[model samples]
Target: AVLKATGAKGVAEPAAVLAAGGGRLLVKKMKWKNVTVAIAEISNPLSVSPNEPAL
Candidate 1:
C-alpha cells in the first residue's frame, strides 16, 4: 500500500533497522498528522549483507 502510494519499497522505521543491518522492532510505527516514528533494536550487524536491499 505504501509502495503503491509513495513508490518507496518499505516504511521508514523498519527500513531504518534493515538498512543498518537487521533487527527486532522495539516500538511499532506511531503516527500523528503527517509525522511518523518508530524504534528498532539491531540484533546482529554482521549477519546482514551490505549488498542486500531492506525489503
Candidate 2:
C-alpha cells in the first residue's frame, strides 16, 4: 500500500522484478509480521543499488 501511494511498483515476486530488468529501480526489502515484501521505486530518476541482482 505504501509503495502504491508513492507511485512505485510493488512486485510480489522478486524473481519477476529481476527478470524484467527492474534492478535499476529503487528496491527495498521489508518485513511485516512473518511476510517479506519487496518494494521497487520506479519514479526515482537515479538507478537503484548496483549490487542488486539483475535476475
Candidate 3:
C-alpha cells in the first residue's frame, strides 16, 4: 500500500540504502517521465522545509 502510494517498486539494495544515509528515498519511474521523486520522513516535526528551494 505504501509503495503504491509513493510509486516505488521496492526498497533499494542494502548498499544503496546505506549510501543514502537516511537522506532521501529514491523512486524509480516506470514511464518515460523525465522527472524523479525522492521521498523521506523528517525527524523535526515542527520544522517546515520546502522540498526544493527557489532557483
Candidate 4:
C-alpha cells in the first residue's frame, strides 16, 4: 500500500509526481469530474521504423 508522507497542508503542492518518477500514475481520492482515469506504461516512446525492422 502507498500513502502520503506527510499530513501538513503546506497551502502549496509539491512538484509534479510524474516528473518526480511517479511512473505515470494518478489517483483521485475525490472525483473532481466524476470520471475515471486510466494509466499505461510506455516501454518505448520511439518505435522501430518499418524500413528498419529489428532482427
Best by lDDT: 1
How would you order the candidates by lDDT, starting with the best?
Answer: 1, 2, 3, 4
Query: Every model's Cα RMSD, please?
Result: 6.3, 10.0, 10.4, 10.1
Q: How should the candidates be ordered by TM-score, best one leading?
A: 1, 2, 3, 4
Per residue, candidate 1 scores C-alpha lDDT tens digits across 1-55 of 6789988865968665675456788787887888777778767856768999644
Candidate 3 clash pair list: none
Q: What would the per-residue lDDT of candidate 4 be over residues 1-55, giving only the tens digit for each residue?
A: 1135455432112222333234333432322354423443333435535687333
**Superposition-based RMSD of candidate 3 using all C-alpha atoms, in angstroms:** 10.4
TM-score of every prediction relative to native: 0.49, 0.31, 0.26, 0.22
Please, what are the lDDT tens digits per residue for candidate 3 over residues 15-36?
A: 2434444434354323235533
lDDT of each: 0.72, 0.54, 0.42, 0.35
Which parts of model 2 are misplaced by more than 4 Å? 1-16, 41-55
Q: In model 3, which regions exceed 4 Å deviation?
A: 1-32, 47-55
How much is 49 displaced in model 2, in angstroms?
A: 27
Task: Supply the TM-score for candidate 2.
Answer: 0.31
Q: Any runs in candidate 1 off by more than 4 Å, and if so which? A: 1-5, 8-10, 45-55
TM-score of 1: 0.49
Worst 10 residues of 2 by lDDT: 39-48
